[model samples]
Target: MTVNDVKMILDACILCGEQYIGKEVHTACGADMMSDVLAFVKDQSVLLTGLCNPQVIRTAEMMDIVCIVFVRGKKPDEAMVALAEESGIVLLSTDHRMFTACGMLYEKGLHGGASD
Candidate 1:
């Protein structure tokens, strides 16, 4: 799905990287644990998380994630947004909780990436 598609599905507001809305993202992963995200996610371009920290952006950078959805109406602070903007990772916020957000995306055909 495209970033715009995900936004529509999640009713998310774009916080940064608006220009990347047309980008295609085949897989998604929803997790608040940065360690699980790092260990389990591979080629998952979209990250849905409730964690609103600079570490989330850093993890996205390390995992080459293209977009992040801060679920349950969570918003990152200025530094985190700046980091995501600098990393060219799109940031979106939604009212949906992590489970609902992930379920919505999954129902819309976005699946998790392969795990080793």
Candidate 2:
């Protein structure tokens, strides 16, 4: 599905890189810990996290993630938004908790892209 579809599914607000909302995302990984994301996340995925920081942007850059959805109403700072914008990574924020957001996406056919 596309990032715009994800935004509608989760009722998320675009915080940055709105131009990239049309980008397609076939996978999703929700984690508060960047370590798990770094270890297992695949490329062209959407990252759903409660942690709002610059490191999240850096991690997305390294992993080639297409979008980030900040859960539980958490919003990143100006610098983080700028970083995400610069990297062409779409940022979205939703009031839903991490689990619900991930579940909603999963129900819409977004997987973690993880292997056994």
Candidate 3:
């Protein structure tokens, strides 16, 4: 699904990189802790997180995640938004909690990361 589709599905507000709404993403993983994300995530295109810090963007960059969805309506601060924009990552904020947000994407065919 495209980032636009994700935003629509999650009813998210774009916090940055609006130009990248058409970006394609097939896999997603949700985690508020960056440590779990770094340790377990792989080949993932999107991150659904409640973490609202610069580290989230850094982790996305390290793992090549193209989009970040902030769950439970959490919005990152301005510096965090700047970091994401500079790194070419699209940021989205949604009111859905972690589990429900992740499930919504899964139900729409966006799945977990590939084990490869």
Candidate 4:
């Protein structure tokens, strides 16, 4: 799926990187633990996380995640957004909780690479 597909399915708002809405996303991972995300390596490009911090952006950068969805209506501060912008990561916000958000996207055909 693609970022546009996710936004359409979840009715998410692209808080940043509106230009990347059309980017293709091969895989997604839902996690708040930065270490968990770092420990695994796959073709994951979409990160669905509730963790709001500068380190989240850095983790995404290191993982080459193309987009981030802040679930449970969580909002990152301006600094996080700036870091994401600098790293070219698309940011989105949604009311769906973490599990539900991950399930919805999974139901729509997005997977966390090889892991179930």
- Best of the candidates, lDDT: 2
Q: Write the per-residue lDDT of candidate 4 for residues 60-112, one digit (tens) a residue.
A: 99988989999988889998898889988999999999899999999998988
Candidates 2 and 3: which is better by lDDT?
2
Q: On TM-score, who's better, 3 or 4?
A: 4
Candidate achieving the largest TM-score: 2
TM-score of 4: 0.95
Query: In model 4, where do residues sit more than 4 Å from their true spots?
Result: none
Assess each prediction's global lDDT (C-alpha) against the native: 0.91, 0.93, 0.91, 0.87
TM-score computed on alpha carbons, candidate 1: 0.95
TM-score of each: 0.95, 0.97, 0.94, 0.95
lDDT of 2 by residue, 25-70 (tens): 9789999899999998898999999998898999999999999999
RMSD of 3: 1.6
How far off is model 1, as Cα RMSD? 1.5
Which residue pairs collide, candidate 3? none
Q: Lowest lDDT 10-mer window, candidate 4?
A: 36-45
lDDT digits (tens) for residues 1-116 of candidate 1: 89999999999999999999999998898999999889777764799999888899999999999899999999999998899889999999999999999999999889996541
List runs of model 1 lying over 4 Å from the truth. none
Model 3: how far residue 21 lies from native, Å: 0.6
